[model samples]
Target: MADIESEQAAAAAGSGALVLFSGGQDSSTCLAWALERFGTVETLGFDYGQRHRVELECRDALRQGLTDLNAGWAARLGPDHTVNLAALGEISNTALTRDVAIAMSEGGLPNTFVPGRNLIFLTFAATLAYRRGLKHIVAGMCETDYSGYPDCRDDTIKALQVALNLGMDRRFVLHTPLMWIDKAETWALTARLGGEPLVALIREQSHSCYLGDRSHHHEWGFGCGTCPACQLRAEGYRRFVAAAV
Candidate 1:
């Protein structure tokens, strides 16, 4: 059968991957995948002045569990770590970083969209990758389940990849493991890579709650079930668990 177990282990030994981790469900899953696929796994998280401090909390919790970096990956590879792009956070006007009241929109970018957030994050990541000599930067962004966030789209990532290589002297590669996969498939991928218990930990321990509410459904991470992010998560988990049985 080629031993799927052995195959996964081999994948873990072959490469070095740096994840632009956000400590959310998607990014955490990507971190787990990187752990299993790369020999040297380092994570970079942003401490941008975002409205959701819960995101920071989740990042810390995942780092404690993963222990990938020496003392909290955020402190190491964050904006304060390699680059000094602190002004981006200060300048952003999006609801994610600002105190803007988010009103849901049916089309176009939502209030949660942080202008040029991913661009800045990825650009910084590419710089870090250049000095470290790492070839790949992994992210957990998804167009399938995300609100009309323009940066989460495939075209944006592809464009950024080209820009990174042209702007920086390094030939860097950007890998979005969850780009094409829907939320249910993401759950399955994490479960297959890290086992059911680990997957459950990701679902329960990680915070996806945009509203910062911990008392949501136990199926997924803590997010207000009413938010767009939470709605997708709840629906995805329901479909995932149902399909598993």
Candidate 2:
């Protein structure tokens, strides 16, 4: 394939975008989408000392795939910048970073909700983009099918965008690709943007399981199927598969 879509995206964007990539299903899809839509895409990751660090391990392969898809990416793409936020581990007591149990209490947010994660992440991405003179930041945050994270809401992101712009005195637009769609629609979008091959690649390679155990595989990545992340991903994959059939 010519990867014409990526070229068109680059032209349309007129420059590059900074993507908050986590090497998970959502962020990987966003990375591929950004490469296809923006002139170039810079990937930024965080190492907040999550117990399941396999997510970060996948970043390199995903970035390499972008180059394979479009030779131009070898130049246009920015090196993956992963920051170590070990301090976050010291401050938060979530299931992601701690040995604590993942639980949801009667409509309340789950124990997996890392406090202020997206806010801090996007802020870091914006600061990095500002330094590089790029004005667009891409996040794969979704309101639907979200894991009850307050920070993932549209209002929170929009508010942060304004705050970052005001704080930095620069115009920055945060783009959320999977904001309104649920997990099933996310799969549909991956198929649309990168075709069946990309979809398959994500299914087999991307890591979304909170448990971080790639040892046991499922149709929807390497999730344990008991955790919230696994449950949601599996359900979404089921919906997408049924619809395809």
Q: Give me the candidate number with maximum TM-score.
A: 2
Model 1, residue 1: displacement in angstroms? 15
Q: State every prediction's TM-score relative to the real structure.
A: 0.83, 0.92
Model 1 segments more than 4 A misplaced: 1-14, 67-86, 105-107, 215-217
- In model 2, which range of ten residues has the least summed lDDT? 66-75
lDDT (tens digit, per residue) of candidate 1 on 1-245? 56998896675455566888766789888877766556776778777766665765666667666553333322333221323456876887666766666775455667787778888899888888787767778998888877867888989999999988998867777989999889899999978876776676788778776666776566576777777778888888888999999
Candidate 2 local lDDT, 1-245, one digit each (tens):
46997676555569778999998999988888777767767889999989788999988877777677667655567868888899987899889999988888556988888898898899889989988878789999999988779999999999999999999999998999999999999999988877787888788878898889889888777878898788888999999999999
Error of 1 at 4 (Å): 17
In order, what lDDT does every prediction score? 0.74, 0.86
Poorest stretch of ten by lDDT in candidate 1: 73-82
